[model samples]
Each structure stands twice: as structure tokens, then as C-alpha cells.
Target: MAYKELIGSFDEVRNYIREFFIYGIKKRSDFSDKSGRTYDNRRRQIESWLDGYMSFQQSASGKAQIISVDSREVVHNPLYKAFKTKNFSDYDILLHFCILDMLAGGKELAFRNIAGELQEYGFSGEENVINERTIRLKLQEYEKLGILKVRTEGKKKQYYSLSADAVDLVSWQDAIEFFSETEPMGVVGSFLLDRKELAGCQSNFWYKHHYMLHAIDSEIVETILEGIAEKKYLELVTSGKKHSEEKIKLYPIKLYVSTQNGREYVLGHVSGASGLDFIRVDRIKKVKTGIRCGEYQKFENEYQASKSYLWGVSSGNAKDITHIEMTVRAAEGEEFIVRRLEREKRNGHVYKITDQQYKYVVDTYDAMELMPWIRTFMGRIEKLESSNPQLKKKFDQDMEQLYSMYFGEAQNDIS
Candidate 1:
């Protein structure tokens, strides 16, 4: 109803920012799930944060708003700002400062004393009274978050602030600067760099092809990691193609991050399923920790056995392994092409067919997943064969289509 920069639901804001800004979904009607006013409100909220990165373009569907950013040029990730803008209630805000001020400077206080001080400070004021139970609950929450430490003394628990040890930023600044731009959960490094102690902090590094948008999915990634570490099943609420939510019971075995695109996926087996599934981390909306899975080790072993056949995330089926052999010509001076295939080919074998030719072969879970990389070596490919006819057929069809586009109907005559 009213415009606000802070969003109550990170999931709702994340979806809007991803669809409109990152994925470039134009036309408000394409959202289909929410009303136009709802879209506008979310858009305005995102714009308020990313106003500098935002741009406008005229498309056939309508005027489109886009967020265009070159990750190489930016010193800090702009997407991390979205995580900072979570809405906090007035009472929550007041209690936060009040509790922190009460426990300032490594001071420890019993629950009763802390409650008395809040009351003395007019926290029990008629306008906004905070009860003892709420204070205790908040303290317990903080203790779990490592912001507060609890010590028991004679039937009473004392709570005090736990501050981080000071690190020499001058020595570690470059590592923090690099990690904040490069690693998953990099926002933690970004937060460290924001400390007031580093008032004169300057970034000494830049990324050439940074994938920063995935920073928004850090919370989901953390939860999945928790599930993985605890060897527990996770209940995942995943948004599907039609915007419908599907709840999956997954026993997460591993996290796969694409080196090429930085897209993250959780490799797990769904409940009662025979084969493992790779669900994109970004598609997940909510995760609930489930009971400890006794069969976790079995699943882990299964994944380990099958991973050798994985080219990417697609594990086609347990029994259906696709074999592919690609022969490519590498002229005398173009040994780099052979070297490139050797370096880039994961789990695949490459051998010299002749002085000027090489054959690369592999048995993978899915040959279809290898199409994009195979396309890059199109002109050099002397022959391409696959156990799956569809893979070869599709490659031929695509080759013919490209030939027609560039060389006209001569492709048909040549065939």
C-alpha cells in the first residue's frame, strides 16, 4: 500500500529482483503471479537500492526496466545491499539498541538485573513496554547467533556480549577484498570490510568476470550447508516453471558450483527416489531442516560412484550412461586446440588419432548437457558420434540451421 525501501520478505524481494533485474523479464504481465501494483511497489523498492545500476529500454512488449552491471568495474557487490534492507519493527529496533547499550563494554548481567535496567531506562514506558520474557528470548536468540555468550551462576544464567577479535586489516585486507568478491557467502567478508575500524579502507582488487547476483542466494546456501553437515534431510520449497511451489524432501549429498557460470546446485536424492536430483540453489524459496537421515552415507557413496559420469549437474539416470566420441582436426601449429580439449574435458579422455587429428571420448550421465561446450569446437570437429542418437541428431539439426542462416540453402545442396 505504501512505498518503503525495506522489504519484510527477502524471498518476495529476491524473486522480483531476480526476474526483473537479473534475468531481464520484461512486461509486468509476465510476472502473472502478482498484481501490477505489487510489481510496481517491489520494483520501486529495488530501484531505491539499485538506482545507479538501473536502466530503461524500449521493447516490443513495452518499456522495460533493467539492471545492467559490469561486475569487473564495481569494487563491491551492489546486490549485497538488498540483504541489508530487511524490515525491522519499531519495538525490535528500540529493544536492539537498549539491550546492546545495557550490555556495553564486556559487561555481564543476570536476566533480572538486565530486565530492571530496561525498565529503569523507560523501556517499560506506556508507549512501548518490553517485558522480561521478550528480553530473555532475544538474549537466547543472540546467544545462538554467537553475539551473546551465556554463563550459569548459582541457578541463574548471565548473558554478555561476545565481540569479534580484531584482525590486522592491513595485512588481511587484500584477502578479504578478494574473497568478498569471489567466494560464496562473500557478504560476510563485505560486512567485515564495512567495520568502522577500517574507515580508510580501500579495495585493492577487482574481478574480471564476477558472478555477484548469486550473493542473494547465500541464505539458502547456508541452510543447505547446515543440512549437509548435520546429515539430515531438508524440506525444500522450490518455485517451478509455472510459479507453483513444490515441497521436496531431499537428502543433500553435495553442493555443485559451476566454474563457467557460478550457478549453484544442491545434489541430493528425493525421498523414495532411486536417482539423485540437482536442484538449482536459486530456485529454492525456503528450507526446513528435517530429521537426521540414517541412509545419508549410502546416498553419499552412491553419489561418489556416479559422479565420475557427471559432466555437469545432469545425472540422467542410474542405468543410462551416454557415450560420446568427438574427433577434431588440430593443424600442426594449432596444438593449443588439442591442449584446450585436454584441459577443459572433465572425466573425458583425449588421445591423438593422427599427427594433425585428435579423438576425445567419454561416458557421461548426459551427452545433451555437453552440447554447448561441443559447439565451441564446431569448425574443428571432424566427426561427432554419441550412444544417444538424439544427441547427434540435435547437433546435426543445429549445424544445418546455422549453415542455412549464414550460407543460405547451400547447406541442403551440400548435404
Candidate 2:
């Protein structure tokens, strides 16, 4: 009911940030599901996290505010700050520290002993006494998180903090600092970097094409990854402009990160569907892991076999493969163009047809996805062909329009 920087539900915050701050611009009244006060509070929360990147404008709909960030410029994701602000109760905090303290110095205790020790601290929240049930619950939670390890002694269970050799922060500081700023689960590295031993550690790296938005999508990505690791089917809840909650069931195969835009996707085989398709991480609202997939290996093998034909995420038109060939002329000094083609032509081949002429060929599930990359060689392209006549026609029409726009109808021939 009241405004606070700390959030209770990340899903609710993620939805507001994606819909209003990251994806589109909208007036405050556009949110029909929530009251104006709620909208204002959510907006303020996001603005606080994205302090320098936010901007406001007077639009036809009304005055609107948006988070405008150039992904290439930022060294780290500001959105990670929102995730760090989760609210915790006084009892939860006290119990966490108490447990760690009790289990410190290689001390191990049975459940009853741990509960007795916790009671000795006189811990209470909201006037309720901290009972054995609460202490047991906290221990269970920590055991699942690997913070505590449990062992059975006959019929009784003993719990102790999981200990490991201390990492040499001096030796690994740079790597951890770099990972914290750039990796998908960099937030984990960030937590490590925050330890008091590394208080003065700083990152010496920066990315030319840093994508800051993925931090917001990391939670869902982590869930999908868990399903993938366990070889389980995932029941996903996806939302879009037209569809608020479209449920999908899939055998998740792999997580794909786009090199072009840094967006993340999950390549999975939909239940009862024929082939693997990619689901963009941002579209996912919730991921509920389902039953263990008995045929996970079968689908993974199928994806590996079919992935060669994938130019992009499109699994292309239900098994209809398209072939494309193009000839391009690059003058003697433009060897860089040839190298560029060789570097970017995924699943495609390039060979010199002549001193100045080169031929590029590939088979793909969807040739349409390659159009943008093909257009980059407009002036150098001498000939082009596609097995899908519609695709060729679309490319020809687009080239013709470009020629007409720049050179007039008299010089409408792009070839």
C-alpha cells in the first residue's frame, strides 16, 4: 500500500518495468489493472533505479516517462539494483545471522540443539516468539540453498554451515569484478565482490556493446536453466501485447544468447509440436518446471541436428528448407568485405568465383531472416537467387524501391 524501494514481488515489478520503462511509452492512465497511485509508486521505484537514464516527454496520449538507455554505453546494469532490494522481515534477518553464528568455527549441532541456541538469543518478530517450527523452517531453507549442510546421525539430523577453502580475492579479484559486470548471472559474482575482504576491489574492464537489460530477465532465465539442467519439461507463461498469459509446455534444450543484440532466448521443443523453437526471455512471465522429460536426450539430439540450418531463431515454416545463392563483386582493395562475409556467414559458405567476384551459398529454414544481412552488400551483389520465389521477389521489390528512392525511376535497376 505504501511506496518503498524494496519490492515484495519481483514478478509485479518486472512486468511494470518491461511494459512501461523498457519496452514502450504510456500515460499513467494506460494501466487499467492498477490504481493511479499504484502506477505512480511503480514508476517512481523504476525511476529511482534508473536515475540517470530516465527521461520524460509530452506526447499526444499525455505526458509520459521512459527509461532511455544506450545499452552500449553502460558498464553495468542499473536494473540489478532493484533485485538487490527485496524486503525481509526482522525475524528472517535475525534468524539468518543467528544460524550462521551458531554454526561458525566448524560447529555442528543437532536440530534440537540449534533450536535451543536460537531460543537463547530471544528472537521475536511482530510480538510472536521464535518457536522451533520457525527455526527448523529456516534451516531447511538454508540447506536447500547450500548455505547449510545436514547429516543424519542415526535418527537425528545435524546441521552445520557448508564450508569451503577461502578464495584468494587478490588473485581472482579482476576476474570476479569483470564477471559481475558482464556475465548473465553476474549478480552472483557481485555478491562475492561485496564481501568485506574485497571491499576495495574494482573492475578494470568495460564492454563496447554491453547490454544492460538482461539483468531484469535473469530470474526467468535462471528458472529455465534449472529445468534444462534437470532435463525436465517446463510450463511457461508468456505475455505479449495481444496475449496477456499464453501458456506453453516445452522440453527446454538450451539457452541462447544473441550476439547481435544480447537478448536471451530458450530453444525448446514444445510438447506435441514437431520441432524446436525459440522463446524470447523477455516475453516470459513465469516458468514452472514440469515433469522429468523422458525424451530429453532425443529432443536435444534433434535440436543439434537441425540447428545447422538455423540462420536465426526461426525454425522456418514447418520443415520447408530454403536455399539461397548470391554473387558479389569486391574490388581488389575491399578484401575487408570478403573477410566480413566469411566471419558473419553462419552455416553458409563463401568461395571466390573470380578475382573480383565471390559466391555465397547457404541452406536455411527461413531465408527471409537473412535478408537484412544480404542487403548490407547491396552495391557489390551481382546476382541473387532463392528457392523460395516469394523471398526473391520480396528482396527484388525492396531493392527496386531503394533504387527508385535514391536514383529516380530512370535508374531503378539495382543490379
Task: Report every candidate's CA lDDT.
Answer: 0.84, 0.82
lDDT of 1 by residue, 1-415 (tens): 6889987778878777777878776458686665788888888888888879998878888877888888878889888888889898886787788888888877888888888888776776578677777888888888888777888866666746655655677688888888888888788888878877655687777778888878989888888989999999999999887668899999998888888899999999999888889999989988878999999888999988888899998886656898999999999899899889989998879989799999999999888989999999988898999999999888888888888789785365322
Tell me each candidate's TM-score. Answer: 0.84, 0.89
TM-score, structure 1 vs. true = 0.84
Off by over 4 Å in 1: 29-36, 101-104, 119-124, 154-156, 159-164, 326-342, 350-360, 375-385, 389-415
Q: Which 10 successive residues of model 1 have the least lDDT summed?
A: 406-415
lDDT for model 2: 0.82
Candidate 2: regions farther than 4 A off: 124-128, 197-200, 240-243, 317-319, 329-338, 352-357, 394-413
Candidate 2 per-residue lDDT over residues 1-415, each given as its tens digit: 7688888879989888887877765567788875889898888888877789888777777877777777666655677888888989888899888888888888888888887776678754556577787778888898888788888877766756655546787788888878876677877777777678777655577778877778888788888889999999999889867656888998898888887777888999998887788999989998889999999889989988888898888885545889899999999999998998999998979999999999999989988999989889988889999898977887888888887787787344444
Relative to the unseen true structure, what is the C-alpha lDDT of residue 191 in candidate 2, on a scale of 0 to 100?
Answer: 72
**Candidate 2's error at 292, in angstroms?**
0.6
